[model samples]
Every structure is written in C-alpha cells, then in structure tokens.
Target: MIVLDYPYVSRFLTDSVLELGQAVLDTPQARRLAGDAPLHYIDEIEFSARLALGGKVYTNSENGLGHVLRCRCNEDLARQIDICKDKALFRESVAALHPDYRFRRVPFEDLAGLDAPDVDYPFIIKPTRGFFSLGVHVVNTPADWPAAVRAIEAERAALNAEYPEAVVSGGEFIIEQSIDGEEYAIDVYFDAEGNPVITNILHHTFLSADDVSDRLYYTSARIIETWLLPFTDYLRDVARECGFRDFVSHIEVRVTETGDIIPIEANPLRLAGWCVADITALAWGFNPYECYFKELRPDWDAILTENQGMATAMVIGDLPSSLDRTRIRDVDYEGFQSLFANILELRKIDYHQYPVFAFAFVSLPETELPALKQTVSQDFTRFVVTE
Candidate 1:
C-alpha cells in the first residue's frame, strides 16, 4: 500500500504532495518503479480533513503502527486535532485540574483584561490557536502589555490582508501566567496498546541577544534519566487525562525555583525539524525518523538500554550575513559536522530561511560541559556560510 504523506498544513498539502511525487520521478529510484502499476494515492491530510470536516470516519487498520491504530474515530477528534493548534485543548484540560491555573481571555476589541491583578507581569500572550512563536509575546509589565497587544493586532491585520477568507477563527488570546524556570521539551510516544513511552527529552537553550528573548533552539537525547524519568508517571497522567492517545507529542515544562515542574505547553505531533532527530540519535544510537517510517528494528529497543552518563548539547550559529541576498550552494558542511568527534549520529540540516539558524548535536563527557561549550564558542567560525 502506497502511503502518500503530505505536509501537515491543510492548505499546502495538495501542492506539497504533487511536488514530492515529481521529486520522486526525478530520482533514479523512479526508473525501478517503471514496471509497477499506478501509485495508490493515500493522502493523510485529505483523509484526516475528510474525517474532520465531512463527518467521515476511519479505523486504525493495524496495530503497532500508530496509537490511533484499530480505532473508530469521528469529526470531533479530527477537528480537535486540527483546530486546537499547539495542544491548546490539552492545556485547557489540565488547567481545569487546578484552582490556581486562572487565565483571563483577552478579546481583540478590548485587550485591557490582560492587565488584571494577581496576574503576574512578564506573562505570556499568545493566540489560542497559534503555532511556533508567531504572534506570541512576553509582556513584562503593564507598560509592556499595550505594545504587545498592538504588535499582535498588527500581525493579525497583515494576516487578514493576505488571506482574507481565512479569518482568525479563534478571536480570543490567552494570557497565561508565565512559569519562570529552565525550559525543557519532552517527546513522548504512545504504543498501539496505549502505553506512555518516553521517546526523548530535550533541554531547549535559548540563543538570542539580551534584547531579544523569543528565538530559541533545542537539543535532545534518550538519556534523560536524571530528573526526567522520575516524572514520567506525572507526564503520562497529564497526557492521558487530556485525551491524547496514540500519537507523538512534544511537552514543554518549566522546573521552577521551588522545584515544581509546571507544564508550559504541549504540541500533539512530531517535534518539528531535524535537531531533535539528530540529538536523539547522537545520544541513543537510533533516529526517530526510523520510527516514523515504521521500521521497528531491534535498534529501537537499544535506546532503552542507553544510560544517562553523558551530556549532549546542540549549538546554533548566528544567521550568516550573506544569506539575505544569496543562496547557499555546495555547502561543505562537513567542517561543522566533523567538530564533534563523539557524535554518534548526524541528521539533516534543519533551519528556516530568514533566521538561517543551524543545529549540531555533540556528546560530551558529563563533567566537561563547561569546557566543551567554551571550545565550541572558540571554534564555531570554521563553518562558513558561502554564496
């Protein structure tokens, strides 16, 4: 059975699917498929959207393939998955569990409610269905709230102009009390039988100027057995309580000064980008891409045997000056990749166009983290960005 996986975005899936098929046609592998019959088109997004919008349904058809395996599903599940971007429903579900998780909804017309009392300054303001950090802002005080609100308003106006029909369906913005602490992302996968499996845990290191706080990068590993493993039960309970079953999820949490692990947000899908896959492989000897392809090899099990003796970190370089006007070609990226001698695995380059950030995963002896970071800062210039 041919499974045509399209980009996750519903609007771009058609073009992305056609482009993927065309790329396949240009490859040498396509010649080998010349004798095969017509390719069976199985569009995941279309199928999902049909179930979501058209009130259609689907069964899992197989076990161990996905958490949704062999299940009866409806439009509600699909709509919830699609419309509640960034697992907003999960956050709302968990919020109901606590009395102190109070949040004030700020409307586009009147954003003054965001300045309510007991509501701490420097809190996070984000669209209810936002992705990435698109329209998110951290307002430090009452003085900062107006500017943040105006910024979001300007962004919404721009989006409305570009896609007039696609109005912002969720009119409210969420003003959440920020959890001050070190930020970490945990990637969890559930088996077909409904077991909470910890795939990887990544400590996101923010790389930005003192003036800019939103830009961030991450590195991950399977060896997060120190403080993470002990909290797996808590995370699992949170996931199950939120109605998340067989799927990949990225959970971000903060370990506060009081030693409480507060849930920040959750994304109910594969963690975007390659840095995650690179770090997971470097530390555990198996890449999650393999799991995505349903390979299910014995090496997947080897990750469980991996110990938490080493510390792995990902260093992201500043955007190259020449990237704005030029396209990078024939990049001899080996110089950057070769710097880490202890790197067990290397994944593909993952970066967005504008920021031009690049990630590399390096494994260091747990005791040598400080010196390693210093060495990286000293030696990072060798990876040149060329036009």
Candidate 2:
C-alpha cells in the first residue's frame, strides 16, 4: 500500500505503480498529483484493511504520515514511524549502538536560553522533526548560537504554513554533536524477518562543513561496492535494535575515519523526496519501487561488474533563501543544464510554490567526481529571471 502526498510526485513512480499494480491510497492530493493516470486506487477502508493484514506500507512524503497513523494497521508500523520521525526518540532507541554520541532535545522557546558554556562546541541544531534541511544549522562557537536561533525564528512562521507540523515542526529542536566523516544517503527496506535489503546508495557531497543544502547526491559502482555490505550490516543492527520489519526508509549516515557508520536520521516510508529515487533507475537498470514491492534484491556482484566506471547523481537546483520566490519570473533550465556534463533527466519544479527550480539526474564518468563538486558551488542566481 502507498500514500502519495503534497509537494511532488514523478512520472517514474506513476509508471512503477502501473507496472507493479500497486494500490495507491485514494486521496484528493493523490488524485490531483497523479492526475487521471490509471493507477489502482483504494479507498480508506481497503487501505486500512491491507495495512492491518501486515501489507507493506510506503509513503513518498512525511506529510502522508498522518494518514498512515490514522490507519492504525500494525502497532509496530506506528512505533517505527514515531521512532524514526522523532530525532530524540530515534537517538535513544539506537543509543546502545553509539553510546558515546552526545545529544539533547531542547524546546524551541528555550533554544535561546541554552547556556553556551554547557554545550559541546560545534554541534548541530535542527528541528526535532524536520524535512529538506530547513532550520538546520551548525553552531561552531558561542557567537554562532544567536544566528542559528534567529534563523530558526525567521523561518518558523513560513515553515509552519508551508508544511504540516507532522512533516516539519518548530516546537522542538535537537542539539547533537556533529559526526566527522564522509556522508551517504541510502534507500533500503527491512524484510518480514527484519533483514535489511539494500537498494541504492548515494554519496552526499557538500562544499563546506557548515553547508546544509540538498545540492548533490551521486552514486557509482565503486560506492556500492565499498559501502553496500557495511551499510547493510548497520541497517541490520538498526532493525534489530528498533524491531523494524516490512519498513522502508531513506537514511543518512556518516562513515567515521575509523570506518564506523553512525546514523544521522531516517526519513520514513520513502526514498528521496521529490522522486529523487528515480536516480536509481537512471543509474541502474531497475525501478526502486519494484525492487521494494517485489522484494527483488539487486545482485550486487553482477551489477558492480557490469557498471564499473559510470556514476549517477541527483543535483538539486534550490533557490537561495535570499531570493524572493514571489518575484521570480522564470528559470533558464537550459542555461543551468549547460553546467553539467551529461543530464539523464531534468525535472523542472514550480519555484513560485516551492523553493527549488528543478532536480537534475546526471550520468557522469567516475573520474569527473570533482566536476560534480564544482557544480554544487556554482552561483545558480544567474539562471533565474526576476521582475
């Protein structure tokens, strides 16, 4: 069973639904986003019935989490969602895995009052429940604390109005010590027996330590060959500790210098947002949706051998916060694509309603990794036309 919610959906997903014959929960939002596509639509009753029967559940956006909660299908399903969505709870559940990791949850009202001397230097502060990296800031020193608080305050109202509190809330914020290492975002689902089945792994690249934007995520045969086994082992530990089964999650983690995989957080019931999961299809020759629904695990050994030198990436064209979205006239998508070497697909988004201009899936030579990094730091304002 799948629940589609606001923001965006993709042609790849709809095609997957048609191909897999997956039942989408019939909601107005789903109908509108999905259009008149001949998808198998199920009513609320059937949705709940299927869920109660222990059918697999997946949601494209956390906004649809409310519908999943209301269905009350499986107790563990609800529990798993709660634990994954709440950063504090998620930290506690997996504390045994990283006993030395430091973290604390502070109410939004008290964020400004936190004693600077008491906090560990250079920690990350973000909404307890957040999506898309909004309100995420790295406080390197006491002087940076005020700026982080003000930034959160500035975005609070817009955040509340733009996203449901379930998807993103400013009620509470989490302060945790930053993990130092290479970061990666993974898409995986646990089977009925709580064994994790890995689907795709993308290396998340950032220009600087303090940069927190959905700028670039790329994967290659080398990445999969290197981290697939270790990440699967890490997920198994997470599943065992959290009692997760028949659950799908898009998880972010950091691999330390010592080769330890420390989880950042898990976005429940989906791969990447705005159908970035399609990067899997662009990179590999399979649909991630089909992989999950049919429990079709990738033959990693064969896959790695076949695609040894190629790399795939999802590059987000996010509008800078300084730009006034309402005044934007148009985006020169062609101008932006000129920056990349090869674009597999260019998904243009309505920046007037959303902050992003588009999501580009690109195929590049693994040797051109530095070019991908350079593309992330380019001044995207040149591509926008403002009144």
lDDT of each: 0.48, 0.89
Per-residue lDDT for 1-387 in model 1, tens only?
112121111212223224334212111222232224333343445444433343212111111112222132453343334422433455667764445765665666677444543577667777665444546677777777678877777777533321111112236677787776777777665454435566567666543221222223334334364555555776766655666554555567777788667786765445433224345655666544344324243243445456445676665543533354244443446776666667544433333332334455576766666565455554333454546
User: What lDDT would candidate 1 get against the real structure?
Assistant: 0.48
Give the best candidate by TM-score.
2
Please, what is the TM-score per model?
0.64, 0.98
The local lDDT score (0 to 100) that residue 41 gets in candidate 1 is 41
Best lDDT among the predictions, by candidate number: 2
Candidate 1: residue 245 lDDT (0-100): 53
Clashes by residue pair, model 2? none
Per-model C-alpha RMSD: 8.2, 1.1
